[model samples]
Target chain A: MAASTIMKKTGAALVAPVGWLAALIDPPLRALQKATGLNGMAAFFLAPNMAIFGIFVLFPLVINFAYSMTGGSALFLSGRTYVGAEQYERLLTCENYLDKRSCVEDLFWNAAGNTALFVLFQVALMTVVAMITALILNRELRARGFWRAVFFFPVLLSPVVVGLIWRWILQRQGLLNYLLHQFGIDQVLWLTDRFWAFAAAIMVSVWAHMGFYALILLAGLQAIPKDLYEAAEMDGTRPARVFWRITLPLLMPNLIVVIVLALIRAVQIFDEVYVLTGGGPGTSTMFLTQYIYEIGFAQLIRNPGLAAAASILMGAVLVVLTLLQLAASRRNQNAGAAK
Target chain B: MGRITLDHIAKAYGSVEVLNDINLKIDDGELVVFVGPSGCGKSTLLRLIAGLDQPTAGDIRIDGAIVNRVPAADRGLAMVFQSYALYPHMTVRRNMAFGLENSHMPRKEIEARITEAARMLEIEAYLDRRPGQLSGGQRQRVAIGRAIVRNPTAFLLDEPLSNLDAELRVTMRAELASLHARLKTTMIYVTHDQVEAMTLADRIVVLRGGRIEQVDTPLNLFNKPENLFVAGFIGAPNMNFFPGQVEETLPDGLSVSFLDGQKTPVKAATNSGAAMGAVTLGVRPQHLHLAQDGEPQIPVQVRLVEALGAETVVHATASGGERVLAVLPGQPAIAKGDRIALSYRRDLLHAFDGDGMRLAGN
Candidate 1:
């Protein structure tokens, strides 16, 4: 009995340090050690993601706000001035600015309206087309993989490349005009006209982005259970009615996701319009992004202060829209759970 | 009301045939159950009847009119699925009214039917609730309610109670039976559980590997099984069989020798030559009794005794080394390794041929 007791004591003594080591090495709590340790191993593990996010997102955001208060080039020692919201006042009310001819009343408000129009039309069109395509491709048709690939191939192409190709096709002597000429029709100016240029930008934006929305919507459609459809059939529900009652209601969550994503991407449209129209045709298609770029870089004398103010305002609007979307999504999930 | 007939029905996927030459007649207002083990084509047959699938060769007729080409929505039949399949997004009232609304029924009539169905299912309080808000049993009741509101000519239930708990299944079974009595609509129910088939079916169709093994009333099938498969499948604990051959013949009976070489006379109708061949003797465990001594007694060494309160089961080996079970009433004072004699009533004995067909009785 004495030997057994000694052995038990020795086992406990051996296990104590090992348990301590295990607790130190545990995944969840090891983070605390990294935070408190002098060696900084935890920071080393977290560096890559943090560095990328800081450089691409956080750094620019901070610099934009700081630059909004200084009047000079973003380059260091380029003659700075502490403007104190003066840049925003100038952009909002200045009448003699060289780019002010592009504005109807106020440059900022006109660009905002143009961006809203572009966002509304493109997002609505892309969502409808994407949902319809996803529904059709999700059926049990022959060569389904081939059809999905055909519909989704556009998303793989670079937006710049897509814009350039469509630019060539929409020009006066391009493929569209050539086709029209085959019918002995007069050439229609697609880019020079203000309405036509706006229409062209919206069309190119949808064409280049519809595939991404379609892929997401297709996944959501496939996630719906097939048994529900069979149950609808057994209830003597017609095909159209089943779609409206069962399919549409169940797909609302996915539809909201598609709408929000498309809206976000649509409002930020730059590359395609830049390559195709260059925000021309008397500023009809000049969006907020182009307007900011012209103020910051395109003009001979870069106005970093004004560009920074515009960027901050656009960021604020985007944040508000995103927060509203998140709140709506949360409410929808809660309602679904409550049922 | 409609009478459904399946004539020489066969189903195949490419080269693999799943159901072959199936023929059945479901009379109007009768509840027929298609029961089998898993992957036995029971669900496929139900789908065929509901027009969810078309048979490869045979024709399906409803009320003497061929409906092989009719789509599911035009078949005028309702189905209750095993998963309930109530629309998760719609309230109970909306789910029941959806079909009527699709058919362009007046809004007032749709509301009335929905109210009636909700009242019938005792879910009036839940008309505004979605299926996700209800329990499994309540969801199933809502599914049934959805079907009732359609007022179809027939109802197809595909293992609709398999999702319920055991106690709820029993209660739902009674509820479904009463519902059938009230509606008197032709119902085709499918299940893998024989208890459900025996209790709920007016007639049970036993299927095995895409073929119909037997179709008969539950009691008749229990008492007179056609073959070894039916006999082995229909009973609980299963009927026990011992290998044997005819040894001699008396004026009134034939003496059969057990594998242990003991001969006992059984009243059998087979001639001596016919009975002299290879045979098997079957007796239910409940038929055997512990005897002190008898002319037909066989000595068995008890290996295990299970004393269930109402009955006792003795697992033992005969002197000839054949395993046997004897079920008796009350507890028997038998222990492991104890020797006992077991006997059965002569008329309770069953004889089968080597192929597992029942032999004629005298």
Candidate 2:
């Protein structure tokens, strides 16, 4: 830890000379800006940041779409032949959409089905739990800072680290079984059993991400004016009644944000689940992200076409979610405008 | 039924005390306004009365029952906050219904109460609209309507009209006064606006530094402020003070003059044993005007003249840089840098003793 911290300091120190060089050029840049109008100068200064964003983010996005349309597994688009909608057809044409076994690429359907279930369970349970935690943290409770840090601590951990920590406690000879044995109960296979493994994955995902959403909701809670609660109290509003009538409705906007973000995160979950159960005891714990990874890299036959198509499908799902988020925020804005 | 008595109520947050020995008896069906500068604990006092906050040491009684330990919801009071605090998501209709719903009132009676309140507020047309859709004044009325549906024993309004614009504030003030007259329910209002206090309250409690400076009718507070702070606070175009020390004691009255050796008061009276020493004499701006040839006057050079339509305010400095304001009737054709002589009317003078307390005999 100390060596890493020293390295970070060195890294920052190494950038100072470059910063000085930029400062030297700043005067000439300002001189040029003075000769030009504001829009020209603004675009001139924005060039570097925009170039970086375009290269890193937008360029890859376009390339991913390009890859989805190509047939063979060529790294470069020039070496690959165009398949038009062939890969998309294989994905969309399922004999029985409900049952993945009858689909042309059955594993993709299975992963997609499992992910839908995961998202529904995870988002519902996580939101309720996070909101409750936020409400409690927002109050003047004892050890408030400590409790807040405790809840948000998991979010700071690497996903692999979080998975490793939970894995030790849930394994067959893990701490959980030992505790159950001490309580005079039989040891249950937590990760080996299909139902339990799926449940465990959902539980771990919720535990890891709940704090982040709770922190957001906490901010929303604190932003509410204190006088409202005082007024509600004077109106003879019962505590539970106040929560239902005032707190819940006023917090709906933030809750929408939490749901959208949590849904997106759940759709992309890979690292923690992969480390925890390796997409098994069967395909029960496999997620759509893992399915994409398996096809793109892990399979004996590397089918980049199929993997890219699956990812494109996932991207479409994300777009719909983002649109839902946009609709929700617009509604929230209308509510705010009324206020 | 809504008589409230705060018995030696004192509040302390940790080691810092905000209110000290506050003893007040608010009568049933009366409107009392607590007026003070910011951070004078007026809102804290209101919250204590509403049972929203507990006093560190004392008891609060409503209708002669000790209610210090009773929860806020059991206090049978409604408060209209400065922010209005209306539930934003609920319709105006539902916002008014929330409190009644908590009480398990029959739905028909709740509807009737809501309808009557909405009609009274002239907000019946907007009942279906959420608070976010209403204008500021409209939202304030809905806040009041929500309070009215409960029909609680009393109402606590903490600067309810302060959020409105100037024109709306004046009308809302009249509306609130008429609301009090119609309901005749006991109310305790808190505001820093002395004008709001003077106009809306039957009696005004002037507070300074966590203690009551004086409490009286509006005219009494205006005409006879009890101290330097109240005198300065209770008037617009605020009262001018001339710091003077007692130079002579006569059988009829004592004589005092401005600290700058330019003028002496026509008459200064001291009630029997009241000590005569360093004193500050206060006169409202309206009492000072263009001097007659023979009358006593303080010479001042004008710094600025504000001709505010019906009246003119001459902001000038007396001898030795003492600032004074003279409000003259109608338009006074005075220019900046014009030297002026101002007369002091003996009857309109107020005197504060060395320690800032009002001298009883004036």
Candidate 3:
């Protein structure tokens, strides 16, 4: 009884300051609520977050669009020439859309081609590998947590660090070739050769990002009820049939999410690949992101307008993909509700 | 042809044993219910028989062959899970057809089976709707239909009616019994509800802490529960237990003295020459009646009275502070603090020895 009395005293002591603060603030808050309404109060509470979002996201987006319509090597919009659609025209102009060599901005076309191919291969490869990894990890294996951590370890590393680490291992005189040499194999140019460099870029990007995607898929896999699987097992379903009918359909929502997110990230792939390949071996690995960086900031004479135009185009594609993801998820939600 | 024999089945996860030394033979077409409280390994035992889980030790024989190595699909058994476990993504028809389709059954045959099962379940109108759209009872029917369409050698239901409301559960229970009569297929059901077990099972297996306590017809189990646990578990209001000691061994019965100093004659026999110093007397609430002037009496002070129009349940505290329940026919003039003597027939008294094993007698 004495201990409980002491506890009550301590509780009151702790609550006193909070009570004072609430009393001090309650009058103004109530007055504000009376002056405005619940919606206004909600907006008041949301003001800080909205301010940060507007400054960081919306403001820069408007600036980027403004820059896209102008052409110059100028750092400020005031010094730049307002040549509406000129930057877009230069990027779009080509003798033949297919042949990059016949285009006015051949490097831009080449980069676009490389990026398209990269997005196709990298997204497909990443999703499949991630799915396979998630399935394996979801099984009852020894040290399962350890294996999951190992798979997700790459996601914690900076993209630059991932790029540098892989470059050291995949370079001509690197660990991979050195190991191969010990096995009586000759050295091969991993980053210097055009095909090998492109392949290496794809491999490293998948290696770096697959873990994050796999974790998402793993969560999706776990959400499926164990009893459903048991019921299926009792029904005498083959493992393959079970996977196709039960696992796939249930996992479609997460799968759609992973695919679209991977697609967006793949299109924006530059940091790690740039650090690893440097768009080397006669621009064979140059993607649209690297091309934008080279024109906007890296070159001796910057073309911010052209770079902004390219980025806006990429943003358009991402928006379309985002819309697709939303539609797919909405359909899934409807189907789930119907079920 | 689905006479399942479980010979010395034992299951364990690492050092923790869930079920041990279980042996039973379920005759073909018999509907046996395994009844026990939760964590009794009843569900685990059912899973082992379904081939969803492999027993750590022993042979599970289906028909005449040992099928310990057979996969669940190959074992030819269907199970209705507690959650209904209906595929939420598929329409009711597709969910029912999934198993047959997996077996590579022809389209026409699969359709026919699904149609028949749907018709029998009275879910033909809801066949095109998914499980999420169906009511709990409808989903339950679909789950049963899914199992029925498989037409397996036997059916295993793991508390299939548990998710339904009380009224629906009663309705479904009758439906299931009727369905079993129509099918005459071997079924192994597991439930913790004694009423369901008593109403449904041809023979009920009473399990306790991973061991079979008793396996007998429901009425037999109720009439003669091999031990204290079965006696207490099988009754609704729970059989009232009174601490008692055997005072004298008579030629026809034994005279026992209760903690309240009430002496009663129990019509029970012991093993020849076995000592029975301390024992317990059990009497079902329904068997107890208001005592007459010259009858064996247990005087108790009424604490709570539950009047149910047709019957009244008197909750009273005996002299030794034991809570006694007496379900008297019609409303008795019983109320809190009323001191009344409860009595029972000598033959209706159940006596168990010190070890809780019932003394043998009718």
Q: For each prediction, how big is the interface RMSD? A: 1.7, 1.6, 1.4
Ten-residue stretch with the least lDDT total in model 2 chain B? B266-275
Q: Which pairs of residues collide in candidate 1?
A: B269-B362
| Candidate No. with top lDDT | 3
The TM-scores that each candidate's chain B achieves against the reference are 0.88, 0.96, 0.98
Judged by DockQ cut-offs, the docking class of candidate 3 is: medium
Better of 2 and 3 by TM-score: 3
lDDT of 1 at A51: 99
Model 2, A1-339: lDDT tens digits are 699999999999999999999999999888887888788898998999999999998898888788888888766779888888788888777888777788888888889999999999999999999999999999899999999999999999899988898889999999999999999999989999999999999999999999999998999999888877876776677788888778887788999999999999999999999999999998999999999999988988787877888998999999999999999999988767656
Model 3, retained fraction of real contacts?
0.91
* Candidate 3 residue pairs in backbone clash: A236-B73, A339-B132
Superposition error at B358 for model 2 (Å): 1.9
Tens-digit lDDT track of model 2 for B195-224: 889998899998877888888988899888
What is the C-alpha lDDT profile of model 1 across A1-339, one tens digit per residue? 699999999999999999999987787557766677845766767889999999999998887888888887654424677888877776666445455554433656667778999998989899999999999999999999999998888788888898899989998789999999999998888887899999999999888889888998898889788889998776677777778887888888878878987877877788889889988787888899988898888989887788889888888878877886797689778966875
User: DockQ (Cα-based) per candidate?
Assistant: 0.52, 0.60, 0.73
Mark the regions of model 3 whose C-alpha exceeds 4 Å error after superposition. Answer: A1-28, B270-275, B360-362
Better structure of 1 and 3 per TM-score: 3
Error of 3 at A158 (Å): 0.2
Docking level for model 1 = medium
- Cα lDDT tens digits, model 3, B1-362, are 77999999999999989999999999999999999999999999999999888999999999988988998888888899999999888899889988888778999999999999999999999999989989999999999899999888899999999988999999999999999999999999999999999999999999988899999999999999999999999988899998888888877778789856668777776443443588888999999999999887888999999999999999998888999998999988888899999988878888888898887535
lDDT of 1 by residue, B84-174 (tens): 8888888888888877877899999998888888887788999999888998889889999999988889999999999999999999999
Q: What CA RMSD would candidate 2 show?
A: 5.3
